[model samples]
Target: MKSIVAGLATEHAENGIGPVVLMLHGWGDSLHSFDALVQKLPGFRIVRLDMPGFGNTELPKDTWTVEQYAKFVAEFCKKTGVQPEYVIGHSFGGRVIIKAVSQRFLEPKKIVFIASAGVADRQNVHNMAFTAGAKIGKALLKPFPKSLYLRLRKELYRVTGGDYISAGALQETFLAVIKEDLSSDAAHIDRPALLVWGEDDIVTPVEEGKKIHRLIKGSELKVLSGAGHFVHQQKADEVAKLIQEFFI
Candidate 1:
């Protein structure tokens, strides 16, 4: 139940292995989200953490940017004496890791992003609509929550993944990630990277995975059939198998 105070992370770690593997959960998810993967990975020491305002972890007293969060994660790594040789991040956590890598934080020997979100390209008309909705959402909030906001996110949760996330945290994450354009920075990622996605992913989309593969030379992309936005959860064994294949 111990955690690093990034105002963003609460961690779970098991020591005694060759190197540490820090697992970062997505928004609305706790360290337990990575439970399946950790169980599959008996070869290395594993650490999973709850992100801010998502699970047991509290959001920072001050509103922090993704870059700041990246610094926090890096600082957390430094303090733990873990020296992770590999790192894994899911969804929103994917963005955070990229931000950290861009700033040259905890450079790992290998990195994996499951349904990542660094691509700036939009797929079609529907994506444009989502962008519009996000823009409108940022303008008003804090106390007066409209029905539209709740419905929109609940629908996204239902459609994208099965997790029922808090509207407030979802709104905050949406606002934080929408304006981000990681294309320029992604080109700089030189680590051995793996990008995986569910063919049915609605959140980050398979296109996002494709874009990551394209941007990061030599990176590999694997699209699992019949999987959706919460592919990591829905298809944990498959995802974990790939991670094992990549990490080993």
Candidate 2:
């Protein structure tokens, strides 16, 4: 375990492996989310980035979009010499990985998206309009505007479903990721892939996973029964097992 200005990172390595696996966490989550899986995978070196603004890394003033986050990961990989042979992205991280792969930032042997986003078919449960309302409500709450502020706050929650982004830094600290279709770019990757989905996933439903499987030619898809958006978290060992087999 070591510390960098960005955040704390822990590295684990297999006895003998030529490749590395880099883990990216879902939005509002930290690297520790995959701690158990990391310990279990002793055959391949694993590195998890505690993405800036979450986990050990302090939040930055520059609001991070998926592309910006991907670039950060790409640069981190370059500086660390940890050329990922495999990448496993959860939710928002999945979007970042797509950007990296599409832009040729990192050429991993295989990539995994665990209930990812960035696809048009994904039924976004989190309506982003609420995010803007929340910011507005918070900003308008200064001078005894209680009634108006409360009205806006309720409206925002009804839309975003909850406070995913705090109001303070506009597009600098936190911003909703613009939805971009990646079906074509993902198909072009041509790398081996594993798409794990939970049948009960509300965030990115199983249908989206199936569509992804179809788009990324020759990719494999696995659906877990009774699992939600966090399928890997619920069944970490099983997910790790599948990944281990694919990596080997």
Candidate 2: misplaced stretches above 4 Å? 1-18, 120-151, 163-175
RMSD of each: 4.4, 4.0
Model 2 lDDT per residue over 46-165, tens place:
778777766666555455666777777887887677788899998878878888898888889889988887674633333344445556766766465678766765665545643243
| Model 2: how far residue 193 lies from native, Å | 0.7
RMSD of model 1, in Å? Answer: 4.4
What is the lDDT of every predicted structure here?
0.74, 0.72
Weakest lDDT window of 10 consecutive positions for candidate 1: 160-169
lDDT of 1 by residue, 1-248 (tens): 66657544465556446568988877666778787677767778886666666677776655556776678778777766667789898887888888888779878889999888756476234444565654454344324467776666566545432432343545545545545777767788888999889999878888889888888889999999999877888888899899989988
Per candidate, the number of residue pairs that clash is 0, 4
Instruction: Report the C-alpha displacement of residue 191, candidate 2, in angstroms.
Output: 0.9
Evaluate residue 63 in candidate 1 and report its C-alpha lDDT on the 0 to 100 scale: 53
